[model samples]
Target: MKNILLIIIGTIMLLSCQRDDTEQIRIKTKELISTHFMGNGVQWSAYPHGDTENGEWGKLMTSEKWEMNFKRLDYMKPKLFRVLDQANWRYMVGFDSDGEPILDFHTPEVKAVEKILSYAQKNNITVLFGEWGTPYKMHDLDAGNSDKFKGANDPKWIRSIVAYLDYLIVKKGYTCIKYYNLVNEPNGDWASTKGDFEEWAEGVRMLTAALREKGLDKYISVAGPDAVTRYDNPNSTYSGAGWVRETAKQLDEMVGIYEVHDYTEYDLVRSGGFKKYHGDIAQLMAHTNKQIIFGELGFSRNGVENQERASRDLYACEDSQFDVFKFSYGVDMADAVIQSMNAGYSGAAAWALDDAMHTCGDLGNKNELKRWGMWNSLGTELCQNPADENMRPWFYSWSLLCRYFPSGCSVVKTDSTGIEGLRLTAGVYNDDITVAIVNNSGVDNTISLNIPTHKQLKKFLYFDGDRAVDVNRFPIPVEEKIDAKHSIELTMPASSFVILTSLDY
Candidate 1:
């Protein structure tokens, strides 16, 4: 009788412990966010200054390097690609004595652009291509030129832009170039527009008229205002959100898409402040019937400190972020994407794909290269460190997002965890669902996902010491198959990102 009582008591204690463990899990239900999840991707640009004489892209374009990079891009399966360029870099050489706007479409620079467009064309990638700004007056190469290019309003500039688009779409057959952005970050005082809304609007008007005249309007439409938010000087007169509102009001007819740039602070994202802040912008643009995308997205943790550190430790550029080297950067970026999607952003393109794409101030000096990319393609040539070419940790999380967040899927928001630094965003397409959960806090949290799916899910995890990758550095599923019929419960490790998707890669 004593042995029987002891066995029963021990069994009861075990059952109680199991029940207690089950009760401790944090349960949250997924809610409908938006049925208009346009897409998600990264900014990929042509390398005009990448040569030994100019910068790092020449080496990256080699057969071997190109193959390696394209393979990785293929695996990522990016849906949207933002490609920005300058006039002088590709076709526009200079104006004639008569100022007829000299142009050449068969230059080596144009060929380099074709390489990018070819890939997008073949892979069916939606490309948002544009010039950096009013190309002539912005650069030192044209400082002494007699051309009086009136920013974007210049007739010559408008004609040149339209002609370039015509050549790409009508001649080269790259229908993949669906949208054209006139100026990048027109709201910033640093941009060519000098934050002049009237000037930018006039430019947009002129470009639209010219596109119609050249019959290129049918092929591509304008995307704006490509303005950056938050990082703008506090005392600045206009904010990025202000620019979007203005664009929607003033150029509603001409604009095909509404977009903005964000280089948010780490706290803003991890604390769930970004969603509320940008959510207002998304709400404001909802009535427009066009999609809003984050044209350029990056993390700017302690902006001044990161800038100072980038100058002191790595490259000597004033406009660079070194946090891309940290694993936590990936966690924060994943959080940003989740928040953006939940906030009604149809799509977002992460700041960049390769460090070799740009130099500080567009100076073309290899030493002043921007350090905000997944990897420096010129690591071997410019930095003399082959290891610099290796993929940074952030690529793991970002790739999963790009690969899994297919275009045209509905992005669903979940009920807030009420747990600081934890976020969830789900993509639902037909009967398939891909859910991403991010925990940017210091401690682990038990999460019971109340998603409506019973299909087998492939789980991919990103954490400091828990990530598993193949020899190619691509993510390997932690679990090849897990039943998701009932509520899915799992422990989200600290500073980690977890993706549970019903779709196979």
Candidate 2:
């Protein structure tokens, strides 16, 4: 009886030791994914999404507010920016006596554009500038509009927009406008093209010809098809992936860069389904020699229901996600970024930079502001709450990504450790390296990262209660210098991520 009791105790001890060892051992193998890391950033539109009557954009542009916002942007260090605008907002005013479009480059709206572009120019940021849709129309079925531009393909619209591009790129010397997106999400019925692929293609061709004719093609190339995924149209069966494949097959030559938008659900991102979903699309454009990017990336929980709930809670627009207020959104978004980089996407721009940039219907109503921004710049004027203007939790993780995974960095992938909901992506820029690890599972994970670099790394943690922020709300490194010559082991808490970078600042 004594011998049997001792043997049982020894077996239990051995099993417990094995279990602990298994929990502590997670060796990740790093591999080179791509040498070209185009960039990562946010959609920073010119002018507020609402009208100027509400003082949305105006208040945000004030000396004090502008300086504060500039400081935040400076710290984020975004290398790619998408500036989407409406035609009537800036140069396109009205048609002339002969029905020709009238252009004005000196309006306040244009000045707002200059503010955005000037910063992009100064900071070497790649600007993907574009129009939302047709100048004065949302849906094709709408009537009572006197705008002469028939559709995106309208010869008049194409010529007018190209002239506007000439003023900015050639005349104003804002050479940072590297690509021009003709229309936003032409695959959707809500767009002016009304999911008419041929119509949108014709417009793209016309715009491309106009750019070439005006010699602007040398400076800026056309980027499309700016489609979005999971767009449910009861009347049509078209999908964003279908749009991309067709664009690759049909409008291959006219397009310089292929791009799309995705508002994925939490399960897709957390379960690593986003990698396969995006990888299939990335494969479509592989032969084109031009890189593909997510022009607008975001999250929506249960689609319209989730957005409506967010609207009720915030008393804002209906098409926004409440998850932006949660730390989980940051973890999920980081997961998406990891998947995107691993899936062969060149880059991704977050849905928006500020909630003040748009309203639900562009009606200028303060109450209708979209709630998908890093922060609301006009929160004080619109929501009467200054706290709404502060950076949300996602900014910590995202800004770390934007600052460290800069343009021209080589994106490195890693072999999976068979750990559910744990992901790793690295970027190497010359001697500097940035490694991001995200744990999306409900349980904690102990990961051993094997990165082959001798540089000292700055570790930034974005857990629920452990985020370190400075006075400016920018992410401060938890550890200033972590020696990365050997394997680095750390515990990644549930719904959290960590960034290890050699680049400081």
lDDT (0 to 1) per candidate: 0.81, 0.81
lDDT, model 2: 0.81
Off by over 4 Å in 1: 1-31, 51-60, 231-237, 301-305, 314-316
TM per model?
0.91, 0.91
Error of 2 at 274 (Å): 0.5
In model 1, which residue pairs have backbone atoms overlapping below 3 Å? 50-55, 50-56, 50-57, 50-58
lDDT of 2 by residue, 20-105 (tens): 55444332334566667788999998655433333344435565666666789899999889998876777777777897878898
lDDT of 2 at 178: 92
Candidate 2 C-alpha error for residue 334, in Å? 0.5
Q: Show where candidate 2 strays beyond 4 Å.
A: 1-31, 49-60, 139-147, 232-238, 301-308
